[model samples]
Target: MIAPARIRIFVDFWNFSLSLRREDDAFMLDWKPVAGVMVAEASQLLGAPVIYEAMHVYGSYDPAKPADGKFRNWFTTWLDKLPGVHTVMLERQKKRNHITCPQCHGEVKDCPHCHADLRGTEEKGIDTRMATDLVSLAWSNAYDVAIIVSSDRDFVPVADFLQSKGIKVIHAAFPPAGSQLSQRCWGNFNVINLMDKFRR
Candidate 1:
């Protein structure tokens, strides 16, 4: 009997979550079943049975923000508990913006309009981490197929590289957004249509 294809899922958490919220804010994701769903869809496209290996979810939280702390808790205490699911939480790097006051032509330290702190956090190294894992895992012969669950076009190069190595990369795409990445991938499935199945 032929061995089933091993599938690994990689998710860019913020990109996936924000996109989902844009489509339907009320939708709550049930994470555990996600691997099964992707595997089933990919199996049909590959014309072969695939087994779920694991899912690696990458996210970032602002260390200075209370709301982010709550999010971190949910990520570490809750999401990390799910079987076969691994989570990597990174600290967001503060953004440095030098805003010049139009009236005085001097650097504005705070928001001139709302008087709020102009500094904010931005995700750094998350994409690099995801890309590294994708390649390293493939090199390790960890999985036969990879299902990338983000619309980030930055993944296009990695997808191309993986395909060159005889590994199939499936893009779990949001229609019309990830066309570039999808086109480079071996296969793609519309994640929007499957959103309902992930709702809590």
Candidate 2:
């Protein structure tokens, strides 16, 4: 008898942006339900363990801290933490942080050119590198495939290099691929299409 295979899976908190961009330019924040479903389905299809870098609410400048005014140092999204109703969401970001690597980790002041929060003007794709380094560490072990769910082209180089190293990119996009994404794929799958079928 042969053993079954296990692939590693990861999701981008930012992938939802492309999904919404499929229909509109603005990013949607309430795709939680959609994202949750995407995770379960991807794992089953790929036969792998999956990871979801916690959701983040940052772009351009910290909305809580406007430019023309005083700097909000506390970085507290909530006005108060009395009941602690939303502490989990707040703490998830408050706990850990990263420097100039647009990691899906916590937010920080960086440069856009280097994913740095410098001057507070880093566009989304400008600074982010994938948070899959831990997964890569695991790769030092033994894994056959790695699946990443994101549409950000910044990951193109990383994905290309991984493929070069014999890793399979299950480039899972939410809204489907535009020309920018299709050009760099050995294979691609859309979770939107998967969910439509999975729900049935």
Candidate 3:
């Protein structure tokens, strides 16, 4: 008998979460069964059974933000407990956002309305980390298929590189948003249409 295809899932946590929130802000998700759902869909697409290897989730939290602390706690305490799920949480880098005055081209140091500092945190290294893992794991022959659960177009090149190496990379896509990413992958499924399956 032929061996089942080994499947690994890579998720951009913020991208996936924000997209879901945009679709329905009130919906809660049970993330444990998400890997199963993706595997089932990939199996159907491939016309073969699949063995779920793991799900790697990448995200960042701002150290100075209170709200981010809560998110970080939930991510580590809850999501990290799920079977076959691995979470990589990075600290967001503080950045001073430069706002140019349209008339004089001067940098605005504070918000005009509330006089708040124009300093914010920017997410760095998460995408690059995810991309590196995708390629490195493929190089190691970790899995036969990879499912990327994000709408970010930055992964398009990674998708191309994997396909060239004869690895099947599937995109868990949100329509009209990740259309370019979908086009680059070996196969894609609309995550929005399957949202009900992941509801908590």
Identify the candidate with maximal lDDT.
Answer: 3
Task: For residues 1-200, write the lDDT of model 3, one tens digit per residue.
Answer: 99999999999999998988889999788897899999999999999989999999999999888998999999988888899998999999867567778999998888889998787778999999999999999999999999999999999999999999999999999888999999999999999899999999
Candidate number achieving the greatest TM-score relative to the actual structure: 3
lDDT string, candidate 2, 108-186, tens digits: 5655578733442223432243334414534684444445566667667766776787765556665445435545755
The global Cα lDDT (0 to 1) of model 2 is: 0.45
TM-score order of candidates, top first: 3, 1, 2
Across 1-200, the per-residue lDDT of candidate 1 in tens digits comes to 99999999999999989888888988798887787888889999999888889999999999888999999999998998887888999999977766667899887678769998877779999999999999999999999999999999999999999999999999999888889999999999998899878788
TM-score of each: 0.92, 0.46, 0.93
Off by over 4 Å in 1: 99-107, 111-116
Model 3: ten consecutive residues of lowest lDDT = 93-102
Better candidate number, 1 or 3, judged by lDDT = 3
Between which residue pairs do clashes occur in model 1?
none
